[model samples]
Structures are given as structure tokens and as C-alpha cells.
Target: MLGASTWNADRAQEIVDEHLSLEAPMLPILHALQEEFGYVAPEAAPLLAQALNLSRAEVHGVISFYHDFRHEPAGRHVLKLCRGEACQSMGSEELAEDLFTKLGLDWNRTTRDGELTVEPVYCLGLCASSPAALIDGEPIARLDATTLGEAVDEARGL
Candidate 1:
């Protein structure tokens, strides 16, 4: 399906069983599983549904709803650039375009060297700061082209 070979049946089931036992929010658990594994395996759907007493369609729907859930492995680092109104007002749109052009990649695409994954996020709760971005989950504000480049370099250990 989707030619996305990221899901491992056995691993997905294992993660589902273990994560569901914790009684935490399913979204968080799903996120963790995706983080640990590269993507949420398809087999996780049934297990998650059974554990949460939800329909399989419901579980699938949640996964599909969030942009964060990937059907493929991300590169070594994830660059989540905010596209909220504040960030937009602060020129994030141009900055995003410049970053993509410089990297020769687009949103949800990994670089050829597997060094980075560029993605777009909505509001990161740092709208006031504007032009916020997260490089591997560390949020930073006041972002410009240079700072974004530095963040990418830092994440890649380059």
C-alpha cells in the first residue's frame, strides 16, 4: 500500500502491545513508536484498535490526520518549520523556500545524503517569537536563512 515499505509487521505489533499497556494517550504512544521505529507499521492498526477499543478505521484515521506520522523513514535529522500566521508574517514563507532551494529538497523529502528531513508544522506554541522551527525537536525562534542553515549543520554534525 502506497509503496511505503516502512512498516514491519512484528515490530509494529510489539510496540503496540507494550505502548498500549502504559495507558498513556494513544497519539503519544503512536508518536513514540514512530520515533523508535522509522514509521508506524501497518500491523499496528489492528492491535491499537483492539487495545483502545476503537475501530481499525479510527486508528488509521488518526495516523492519517497528523502530518507528523510518516509512512517512510526520515533522515537523520528532522527540520520542522512552523507555517503559522506569525511565522508567515515574519517571512517564514520566503525562508522556507530558500531553505528548500538550498537543500535541493522539498517538504517531507529527505536529502540525498540522508542528512535531513524537511517538514512543515502548524503552530508550535511559539507564535509570538515568530519564524520558529524545531531541529530534531529543539525549538528555536528568530530564525533566518543563516540560522536555519546553522541548525541543519548542527543537527548533521557537519
Candidate 2:
């Protein structure tokens, strides 16, 4: 996983300022902030709203609407499990439930140790290899409980 800096209002403002010239720049600004800080801090909405002349609600709506935009920092590693129809048909729902139980996490939640966060992603474009997952952005296809558990354990450095 890429290292992300702690949230800094000044740095966030710099990011927002850098993207302001772009047409329809809200998404870019949000992405930039996430890239720099690993998540969009709640404090960012007011700053972005002021910079873009938008309402805080408008800025927050965009963040909440997008599944990829996290309001809080994720753990050292992120695991995105596919939940698209293809994967569901291939038993991803059951797999996800079992995994969540084993990890003691709900959706989009981090482990107690802060080593990993598990999120649901719709389709990884691996329909042929249904029930796919991505660990820190690296694709892992043809998943099963054992393989997925092993991957998670490895990511957590177990």
C-alpha cells in the first residue's frame, strides 16, 4: 500500500487549489485529497466548499455518494472483495460473510489492530474468474475461503 500522510488542512487546501482550474473539479479534488491523506477528512468539506463556491452539503454528498471516497483513514492494507452479480452467483456472498466473521469485521471496516480494512467492490472485471478480490490494488482471482484467508493473513503479516 502507498504511504499516506496525516491529514493537514494546509496541504488539503493546496490540493484543492491545484485542481480548481479544471472544469468540474470536485471529483479530482476529492481524489487528490484521498491520494495524499488516504481519505477525505471531514474537515475538508468546508474548505473545499469555500474554494469551489459550493455548499458543504454538496461537497459531502459527493463524498458519501462515491463508495471509493472514505471519510476516515483505512488500515495499512485494503482488501476489496467483489460483490457483482457474477461473483454473487459464484458464491461471493457466502464467502464474504464467512470472511467477515473470521476477521470480526463488517463491511468497509478495519480490523482492531488496524492492519487491514475490508470493503465491498462491485465487479473487478474478472467475471470469468468470479469471486475476485483486490489486495492493496493487486488482483486475486479464483477465490475460495482458504486462498482468501491466506491472502489476508499474509497481508496482515501473520
Clashes of each: 0, 0
The TM-score that candidate 2 achieves is 0.93
Candidate 2 per-residue C-alpha lDDT over 58-106 given as tens digits, one digit per residue, 9 for 90 to 100: 9889889988888889999999999999999989999999998888998
**Reference-based lDDT, residue 101, model 1:** 92
Model 1 spans with C-alpha error above 4 angstroms: 1-14, 19-25, 50-55
Q: Give the lowest summed-lDDT range of ten residues in model 2.
A: 1-10
Candidate 2 regions with alpha-carbon error over 4 angstroms: none
lDDT of 2 at 129: 95
Quote the lDDT for 115 in model 1.
77
Q: Top lDDT: which candidate number?
A: 2
Model 1, 13-115: lDDT tens per residue?
6666766656556987787678667677676778788878999999999988987777667787888999999899999999999998998998888899887
Candidate 2 at 17: error in angstroms? 1.5
lDDT of each: 0.82, 0.90
